[model samples]
Each structure stands twice: as structure tokens, then as C-alpha cells.
Target: MKLNLILFFFCTLVTISWAQSPNLSKYNEEIKKIEDTVKYFEVEKINDQFYMLIGGGGNVGVFVSDKNVIMVDNKYEIIEEVLMSSLREITSNPIKYIINTHYHHDHSDGNRAFGKMGVPIISHENAKVRMQKVTQLYGGIYDFIDGFVQDKYPTEALPIITYNSKLTLSEDGEDIEMYNFGSGHTDGDSIIYFKNANIMHTGDAFVRYGYPYVDLNNGGSIKGIIEVLGSIASLANDQTVIMPGHGNLSTKQDVLDLKKSLMNLYQKTVLGLEKGLSYQEIADSIDETLAADPVMPGAELTKLNYIKSIELELNN
Candidate 1:
């Protein structure tokens, strides 16, 4: 009886271990694949909207006026100083409103930096809850407080002003409208549309390069991203300039193209699953049918991940 019990315990432990070991081979390959994609630290003027791109895929927005400025998103904590310097060169106005598009590190990590400057951060109500958890757990708040001697973005830094769907900010003479596109990139994904400039900043939900990352864990969805992009596409025109969360500034056509690619990939995978292909089989096989179009943006989510995302969209 004792020997049988011991054997059963060992087998159960092995099974549990096997279940927990995630294969990171695809992740490593993704990092390698996007390594050559140059990360820009420069600020560029996209139409009337002045924008900056940080390493990774965070798109930082600067709506400048003689009185003050409203920054849509800050890239990373490290890049805050540089981004600030760039903003200062263009406008001497103090940064008043910083709207975070989501809770992703690349986009919202700079929340603390701006908060340090006494700037008020604005975001979806949910983003604050998510960032607060991250700051407490992985961000080492105790160490940060003692060593850095700096408040690593206290709770106040987290969107003192929260909203449900839409919020508008008027700084200087510019009118910027922030809209929550319902679980596109993340649960808190925001798109800042500059009403005066006819430029829209699609935060991460509108990357021009590779596949979009629907962080399903954080309320992201392939279908949601597609829906958001489609809405933006409808609002855009040839004259409308798009500032994506990553990649070069785009036109209305760029949004249309990205939407088409994503929808096509999604439909293809739905059909594949109808034929009873498993998720793995569908993900690994999507590229076979996609055939050398514009690749997806994120390294974390690769071409194969596109197939998996489609599979998820179908299952949901």
C-alpha cells in the first residue's frame, strides 16, 4: 500500500510540472525576429500632432499650445526625461494632462515620471487598478521608495481623473478627445483623437508593422482590435494622419490595410478550425496561407501567434 501511494504521488508531481512548463521557444524566436527593427528615440511632427516613439511599441503624443500641453501617452520611465526635453524644445508649456492608453509597461511605465513632475495622469478606471497591482508586486515599491528615494508613482499618479468611455481635454487651443475602444489592446486601451489637427493617436491598437497583440489576459481581443481599427478607419480620410502606437506615422489607407490583413487572417483561421484543426496546428499553419504580406508588429506575438489569436477569437 505504501509503495503504491509513493508511485502515485510521483506521477502526479510529474504531471503537474509538465503542465506548468510553458514552451518559450516561440518567444525567443520572436525577440530575435524583431531585433533588427530599429527603435527610434527621436520626436517627429506627424501633421499638426507632434509625436515620439519609444523602444518597444509605445507611441507618445504631445498636443502643444502656447499656454500648456496635453500629452496623450508617455512611453517608458527611462525615456521620460528625453521625451520631456523634446517637448520642451517645441513648447515651453508645462505638461498638464497625460493620458495613458493602457496599463502595458511600455506605454504607462512613464506615469511615475510625469507624476513626479506634478502632472496629472488620466486613464481608464481599470488601468489604475492594474498598474497599482504591478507597482505593488513586481515593481518593488518598498525598494524603490528606500533606494531611489523617489515615490515610484504613488496611487495618486494613477489616473486621478478616471472615466468610463470618453473624455476631452482642451489645452492651449487644441481639443483632444480620448475614447475607450472597448478591449482592443487591453481593457483600458484609449485612442486620442486630436479634433483640431485631424490626427488620431491609436495607442498600440493600431501598430502598422506586424500582428497586433490582443493581450487576452488583460482584456485584449483580436476581434476587439479589429473592431477598433475599423471604427478608426471609418473616421479617417486621406487628409487624416494616423499616429500608431509603433512604427512610422501612417495615413487613412494604412488603417484600412491593417484591418483587412487582420480580418483575412481571422477568417482563414475560423475556416481552418471548422475543419477541426487544433489551435497549435492552426497557429503553425497560418503563415502557409498568409503568404508574405505585411507581418504583424509585436515580437512577443509572432506570425504563428496570429493563428492562435484567430483561434481564440473564434472560440470566444
Candidate 2:
């Protein structure tokens, strides 16, 4: 009996460790090292109330008021010290609200750190549900799908408040609204708008990165992206400053251009599917002109990944 109990306990420990490894082995070593060497973070002031925190997993939005401060996305856990230091440069008010745009670690990994400091984190209901199931520290294909072991997240890292469609926050004169664009980047993807500032923080749904990854396993689809992008473009005007999940800040026109490119891809995929082409065939027969469009600018591998995601989404 004693021997059996010892074996059981040993196995449990090993299982837990494996479940929470966070796939450090999968990251690019050189890029990770470069990001690590940066001791400070840069903040770009969008206007009087909104600021963008650059150089992390995702672009963080910092909104300041006389009484309180609000944040959108906290990047990674490794970014804690520098993120906090950068926030201090803007204001010393308490961080009243943290809006997590999605469940991806690059955007929400710092939840544990911020939660410990007593800040309330808010996210779409599905984001909270997915975060509860996430075991790894990295949010990628493996974590989004079923390849890796999933360990439960620490209580501190989970979002405390969750909304179904929309939630609005009033900070001084600025009205911050959070809107959920269902099943685009993830089941719980959200887009944040600083109404007074005329700035939109488009989570992973609209990124400046080469090709956006559609988390098909997590209820993401290219069709949903098409709808979401159209809605986003319609909501903006010439003056709206768009803040993407990655890359430099952009304008409304850029978002529209990306939408056009994605629409073209979606049409081509549909056409190929109608002709009964296999995934490989469809990928191989990509419209070269559309693929080379400047709007997307994603690498071949990234585009291929998107193609795979689209195929999976369509088949299912």
C-alpha cells in the first residue's frame, strides 16, 4: 500500500509539470532573447486620454483620468515590471479596470500579475471560459488546439467580470466601450473603443502582422472575420486611429484594405472548394495576384497556415 501511494504521488507531480510547461520550446529563441533584453517599455500618446504601450506580446492601451486609469490588454507576465514602470510615466491613479480583448497569453498573460495587485480584469464570457482551460504559458496553435496538455490557470489570472456583447466604462469624459465580435480570432474576441479619443483597439481580429491566425479549434473562422472587419470598417471614419493587435498604428483606410484582401482570399478559397479541390490543391492554386497584394504582406508560411485554418473551418 505504501509503495502504491508513493508511485501515485510521483506521477501526479510529473503530470502537473508537463501540463503547465507553456511550450517554451516552440518559441523563436533569437526573437525571445531580443525582447528579453529590453528593460524599458515605450508609450505612445494617442491623445489626452489614450496612450499605447509598445514592445510586448501585444500593443497595450493605457487610458488615464484624474481619478483612475484603465488598461486594455496586459501583454505577457515577463512584461510586468517594465509595464508598470511605463504606466507610472503617464499617471499614478489606481488601475481601475483591465479589459482583456481575448484569451491569448500575449494579451492576457499578465492577468495573474495585475490580479494580484487587486485590479479587476474584464473579458468576453468565452474568453474567461477558455482561460480557465488553458494550461500553457504560450498561446499558439498547440495551445489553441489539442496537441498540448491543458492545465487549469491560477485563480488570479482569470477574468473576474465577463460581458456577453458589450460593456461600457466611463472615465471622466471618455466613454470606453468593449464590443465582442464573435468567433473571429477566437470565440471571445473583443474590440475596444475609446469613444472620446476616436481610437479603436482591434485585438487579434484585425492585426498588422502578415497573416492573421484563425483559431478554428477555438471557434474562429475566416467567414466570421469577414463580417467583423466589415462591421469595424463601417464603425470608423477618416479620423479614427486604429490600433491593431500587432504592428504600428494605422488608419481606417488600412483596415478597409485588409478587409478587401481577406475578402479576395475568402472568395478564392470558396471557388476552389466548389471545384472539389483538396487543401493542398487549393493552396497550390492560390491566385498569385491576390496572394501578392500589398494589403496582406504575410509570409508564405503564415498564408499557408491561414489557408489550412480556412480549410478546416469550411470542412467542419
- The C-alpha stretches of model 2 lying farther than 4 A from their native spots are 1-35, 135-151, 278-298
Model 1 C-alpha RMSD to native:
9.6
lDDT of 2 by residue, 1-316 (tens): 9999999999999999887666544333423653667577788998877899987678999888889998999987766888899999989888998999988777887897898888999999998988887433322322233343333457988888899999988888888888986778878998998887889999888887655666666767778987888878877789999899987899888888888878876777788878888766766776542333243443564555566566667778
Residue range 92-133, candidate 1, lDDT tens digits: 877778888877766776776777777888888877767665
TM-score for each predicted model, relative to the true structure: 0.74, 0.84
Cα error, candidate 1, residue 73 (Å)? 1.2
Worst 10 residues of 1 by lDDT: 140-149
RMSD of each: 9.6, 4.0
Strongest candidate by lDDT: 2
- Model 1 residue pairs with clashes: 210-295, 210-296, 210-297, 211-296, 211-297
